[model samples]
Target: MKAMRVKNGLKISVIIMFIFMYGCKQSSYKEFVMADAVEVSESYEIVEEKEMTYKLNSNQTNVPLNLKIIKTASSRYKVKNIVTATRRIKIIAQKHGAYISDLRFQNDLYKKENRFTIKVPQKYFDTVMDSVNTVVDFVEYENITTKDVTEEYIDIETRLKTKLEVKARYETILRKNAKTVEDILLTEDKLRIIQEEIESAQGRLKYLTNKVAFSTIQIDLYEPVEYKAEPETYTKTFWDETKQGFANGWWYIKSFVVVLINLWPLLIIGLVTFFFVRKRLKK
Candidate 1:
C-alpha cells in the first residue's frame, strides 16, 4: 500500500509539473500576441488579423501580414469637349508634379475618346484626382483602390538577408578550408548562386518600394455629340402660298401633257369609244 501511495504521488507531481509548464507556455504566447498587435497608420488596417489570430492559437510561428498600401485612381468622364479636357488633364498632371506615361486618342463612329495614364507622387494622389474631376463635365465612373503589399515586401527582405548570410558563410568556408582546387571551385559556385539570389531579392524589394512611393492614375475622356432639333422655317404670307399653289398646278398640267403625248394610241382609242357610245345613244 505504501508503494502504491508513492506511485500515485509521483504521478501527481508529474501532472503538476506539466500543468505549470503549460501555464507558462500560455502566458508567453499571450505576451507574444499582444506585442505583435502594434497600432497601424490611419491609411492602413490589419488585413490578416483573422489569420494571425488563428496562427497564434495554433502551432504556427510565422504570421502572414498585408502591410504595404499601394494607391491607384481611375476616372472616366463624358465631357462636352474632349480637346479642352485633354489639355486640362495634361496641365493638371504637370501642375501636380506628375508625368503622362501614356496618351492615346481614338476616334470612331460611336465616340471620341482620349486616354491618359499618369504617374504621380503618392503625396499628391488626391490633389491630382481632384484636379481631373474639376476639369471634367460629368464623371461616368471613378475608382480609387488601395492594395497592401507589406507581406510581399517583408518576404523579399527576409530572403535577401538569408541569402546574404548564406553567402558570407560560404565565403568563410572557402577561405578557411578550401585546400583542393575542386573544393575551392565548388565553394565559389555556391557563393555565386547565393549572391545571385541575394541580388534578385534586392531587385524585387526595390520594385515594391517604388510602387509604394508612387501612385498611378488613368483618365479616360470622352466627348459625346448632343442631339439638336431642326430649325423651323418662317411662315409665308397668303399671297406667297397662293403663288406656290399655282406653280404646283402648272407642274401637274405639264406632267399630264407629257403622259398624253407618250400614250397617243390609247388616247385615240378612248376618243373613238366615246364617239361610238354617243352615236348609239342618238340612234
Candidate 2:
C-alpha cells in the first residue's frame, strides 16, 4: 500500500508539469500572432499611402494632354461713322453671346473715336473678329496674343493634392496619437497652415480657369473729320483796338493805385524825412 501511494503522487506531479509547459507555449504563440498582425497592419498602411501618391503623380503627368491657353486680341481701325459702327459692333457682340466690358467715346478736334473692350467666349473669338471686320473701313493694326499656362496649372493642382494628403495625415495623428494638450495644439496649427495653402492654391486655379475660358478683345474705332484751318494772326478793327486801349489804360491806373496803397508806410516815412530836412535847411 505505501508503494502504491508514492507512485500515484509521482504521477500527479508529472501531469502538473506537462500542463504548465503547454500553457507557456500557448501564451508565447498568442504573443507572436499579435506581433505579426501589428506588422501586417503597418505594411498595409504604407502600401495604401504609396498607391495614393502614385495616383497623384500620374494625374499630374497627364496635364500636358489638355493644354491651357489664354487668348487676347487688340484691333485699331477706321470706320465710316463712329456711332453707326459702334451700334453695329454692339449688335454683332450680342448676336455671338459676347458682352462689352468697357466702352469709351471721345470727340476730338479732328476725329471721333470709340474704344471698346469686349469679352467673348474662346470658341467665338475668330467669328467675332471676322464680324467686326465688316464695319472697318481701314485696318490700322490687329494684334493677337496666345499664352500657355499648362505648366503653372499642373504645378498648382499637384501642390494642392499634396497639401490635402498631408492635412489628412495630420488629422489622423491628432485623432489617434495626440495624447497631450501640447501635441493637439501643434497638430491643429499645422493643419491650419495646410488649409490656408490649399485655399490659396484653389483660388489660383479658379482664376486661371476663368482666364482660359474667356478671350479678351480690345477694339479702337475712329472716324476722321475734315480739317478746319484757323488764321494764325488776327487783326482787330480800329474801334475794337480803341476800346482795348482805353481798357488797358484804366487797368494800369488801377494797378498803380494798388501799388501806392501797398507802400503807404514807406511813403509816410519819406514825407517825414523830407519835412525834417526842409526845416533844417530853413533854420
Candidate 3:
C-alpha cells in the first residue's frame, strides 16, 4: 500500500509541472502579440502623419488658381491712306497702353500695305480692336482666336510640386543615408537632372502666364491705287536706231577678224597644197 501511494503522488507531481509549463508558454505568446499590435499602431500613425503633410503642402502651394486663356486676333482691311492710318493706329495703341511688336510696310505699283503686330493687355483687347476699326474703310476679314491652357497649367504645377518633393526626399537621403562616394555622386547627378526639369517647367509656366495676361492682334492695312499700264514695246528714235546698227556692224567686223586670225596656220597649209597641185596639173 505504501508503494501504490508513492506512485499516485508522482503522477500528480508530473501533471502539475506540465500545467506550469503551458501557462508560461501562453504568457509569452500573449506578450509577443501585444508587441506586434503596438508596432502596427505606430506604423499607422506614421502613415497618417505623412498623408497630412502632403495635403497641407499641396494646399499651401496651389492657391488662388484661375483659368489660363490666351487671346489672339487678326484683321485685314482697306484704308484710305496706309501712312495716315498707321499713324492713327499707333497713337490709339499708345493711348490704350499697347505696343506694336512688329511693323511692315510695302508699296507696289497697285497698292500700299502696312502690317502690324500689336500686343495689348487682356483687359484692353476689345477696346483696342474697336479703336483700330475706326481706321478701316472696308473690312477684308477679321478673326479672333482663343486657347485654353488651364489643364496644361495645372498639370505642370502638380508635376513640379511632385518633383520638388522628390528632390527634398533625395536631399534628405543624401544628407543622412548616403554612406559611399558612389552613392553620393549618383544622388547629386539625379538632383542636377531634377533641377533642370524644374527650371524648364518654371519657364513654361511663366510663358503661359504672360500669354494669358496679354493678347496679340495682327492688323493689315492697305490702300489700293489706280492701275497704270506699262508700255509693251519701247520705240527708239531714228538716230538711236542708226547708232545701234553701226555698233552691230562694227561688232560683226571685229568678230570676223578674230576668226581669221585663229585659222591663219590652217589657211597657210591649204594655200601651199593648192599651189603644189596647180603646178602638177600644169606639167
lDDT tens digits by residue: candidate 2, 1-283:
9999999999999999999999999999999999999999999999999999999998888755488999999999999898999999999998888899989889877999999899988889999999999888999999999999999999999999999999999999999999999999999999999999999999999999988888999999999999777789989999999999999999999999999999999999999999999999999
Best by TM-score: 3
Question: Considering summed lDDT, which 10 consecutive residues are worst modelled in model 1?
Answer: 38-47
| Best-first order by TM-score | 3, 2, 1
Instruction: Give the alpha carbon lDDT tens digit for every residue of 1-283 in model 3.
Output: 9999999999999999999999999999999999999999999999999999999998898865577889999999999988889999999889988899999889888999899899999889999998888877988999999998999999999999999999999899999999999999999999999999999999999999999898999999999999888899989999999999999999999999999999999999999999999999999
Q: RMSD for each model, in Å, please?
A: 27.1, 31.9, 32.7
Please provide, for model 1 over 1-283, each residue's C-alpha lDDT reduced to its tens digit, 9 standing for 90 to 100.
Answer: 9999999999999999999999999999998877666544322455577667887888564555445778988889988889988888888889878899889999776688999899998889988888888888898998999998888888788888888888888989999989999999999999888888888888888888888888999989998764555568878899999999999999999999999899999989999999999999999
Give every collision pair in model 3. none
Name model 2 segments beyond 4 Å from true: 1-65, 229-283
Per-candidate Cα lDDT values, in order, are 0.86, 0.95, 0.94
Residue 206 deviation, candidate 1, in Å? Answer: 1.6
Q: List candidate 3 segments past 4 Å from native.
A: 1-65, 231-283
Poorest stretch of ten by lDDT in candidate 3: 61-70
Q: Which portions of model 1 miss their true places by more than 4 Å?
A: 1-67, 226-283
Clashes per candidate, residues 3 or more apart or on different chains: 1, 0, 0
Local lDDT at 255 for model 1: 100
